[model samples]
Target: MKFKNLLLSWKYPSILLLGIGISNFGAWVYFIALNLIVLDLTNSALAVAGLYIVKPIAALFTNVWAGSVIDRINKRNLMVALDLFRAVFIALLPLTSSIWVIYSVVFVINMAGAMFGTTSRSYITKLIPIEQRKRFNSLRSLIDSGAFLVGPAIAGILFLIGTPILAIYINAVALFLSGIITLFMPNLEKDRSLEQSDSSLSWKIIKQDWAIVLNFSRQYSYIMFMHFLFSCMMVMATAIDSQEAAFAKAVLFLTDTDYGFLVSIAGAGIIVGALVNTMIVSKIQISFLIGLGSLFVSVGYIIYSFSSSFSIAALGFFIIAFSLAFANTGYQTFYQNNIPVEIMGRVGSVFGLLEACLIIITTTIVGVSAQFISIQFVVITGSIIMFALTILLFILSMKPSKSRYYSVKSVEAKDL
Candidate 1:
């Protein structure tokens, strides 16, 4: 089907796609601009890392309640409110010169985002037909990748034209526009018959559903463990990129524009990977694809650690971006396929919580490690660990029970 025609035929799905795409574009712009602002203000790597750390930490604490709220509330309204809240927060960011205020605002923005994100994923399952999930996810990834490809570059240009503060204002306006679009989009009513009739909002639902959650948790334990390992590797590996940018500036005597161009090229790699996933991944066993992707990512990081030249480093970044695209797409599809639609929000939120916790812990560890050891050593060690986990995940994915769940054929044929 033609992409535009596909979207037109699927109205709610189309709205979700557009709203998320626009919002993500704004968010990425804010993210890069905020980091630059922080760095300029503090001139300290630790301060910048701390700003990055706040969101995940906040999500770790608030995700459970957010999940519960998503389960009980109107998903569309929740997302609109969250978007508006984020817009206000972004608008306020430039007004504050205090580091602590920035940290607090970042935490709040992320907390709101976690809530919206869980609901959004669940809503997508409800809105999009099951047979079209692979395509839907591919489209989502493309939008996200496209945003990443353009947002930072735009932010950089805006910063050059005016200031980081002006970029922040633009982000706020974009977010506001996204929220307004969401408000007009069709509201997807939940399957009330599938849920309890009780008006009481207690922890009882979670308590009763604990067994099911535990069962699924046990079944996917290896995937969860691998996620933790991958999270650690990502935290360390990403830190290396930040350090490398500084090193490149100092050693290679590269201009800021050169660094920006290289970063945009890496983003372009992500766009390529997303396009590939959209076109080809539906034909493969998702488990095998995820394992292969992880292996590639680990190899990329390992090579990156040893790279001496800018071209070599850029190649490594390209591979990492490519692998991450496939791996993340495979993993998200696996979750949506396996989990029941009714409990999808809660399940996704729980997973998000776990992911946030792992990221926070890993980022802290890596940030500290960077202070002592070389970024190269950290990247190399993290890559080894990630490689080991990928191997373990591959073995686990081959098991009969796990293999069934991760198979693209099974996912397409089976109902959630």
Candidate 2:
């Protein structure tokens, strides 16, 4: 489906995209402010490092069944509620002077995020026509990339004009706006598998659904393995990011302002890549996109890991961020295509839980090890791990996205 068709569709994916883009901008602003607030409150790099662990830690507990809940509820409604919840949480941040309180709030917010993410994906899979999904995903990536590109600059300006507290409340307001916009999104929760009965919260019902998802995952071993590799790559990327402020300040000798500039550079790179994807690019096989994108991403990280100058580091960031556009778009399309809408939530939660566990462990080890080793060295090591895994993933992605999800019916009809 063309962009024109999407705009012309009554569902109005564009409006949903706009809401997400606004929310994402707010998220980036909140993220920057949160780290700064933590740094000010504790004056310890470790404390800031610990803040990175909050999301995964929350996911560890909540993800076990959040998908079940999401699948049962009206996903669009849930997104609006989650947005409001986060808005309230961010609004409360200024009221607390304690880092612990901040941490607790962040934890709750992350739980909301995890649910919102999973539910949104499942909903999108249903809402958009299959033919249009790739374009939709690309557009979504482009908007998200745009947010990253400008979000830091926005945050920096916010900080200059006022305080971190002010930035937080602004983000809260953005969330509320996001929620209001989401209210316009059409609800598409067709799966009554878990909802038809009153047993959505029942332990037995959830356990039975979990077993089905687990069995399905086991049957699709390659998909699960690939997802695991993606999770590892994600963990590594974030592990490196956890120490990024230190890398900027200590190694590159940058101030907070400079660091924001650096981040914006990465965002700009992604925007360029996304633009290329949405505009000039023709349809490419998902496997090829994933494979080539992974290799490029690895190379980018390698350059970033060993950078000695700000310019070199920015170039590295550019490469990584640019390559991510292709890699993530391919993976997301493949995922949405393959997963059955009914089971998408349950199956996704299992992976979400596992990914969270991996992220926590990866971030925890990196955070603690940095205390003993130089932050640069720790980051370099994580990059090395990421490079290796991406190479492996690139090899795996050469295989076609599962045929069963797409063309099997074509060949099957011929058999008849």
Q: Whole-model lDDT, candidate 2?
A: 0.81
Q: Compared to the true structure, candidate 2 yields what TM-score? A: 0.88
RMSD of each: 4.0, 3.8
Which candidate wins on TM-score?
2
Tens-digit per-residue lDDT, 1-416, candidate 2: 69866458835688889898999999899999999999998899879877777878888778888877877777777788889998998899989888888899999999888888898898888788766767788889898888877788799999999998888998999999999998887656544432353454777877987897787777767766776787788878887888888888887888888887888788788999999878743467666566677778878888887998888999999999998888887777767766677778888898888888877778779888988878889888989989999889887777454545432121111221
Candidate 2 — which residues are off by over 4 angstroms?
Answer: 1-6, 190-198, 247-264, 309-311, 373-377, 400-416
Angstrom error of the Cα, residue 10, model 1: value is 3.5
Worst 10 residues of 1 by lDDT: 407-416
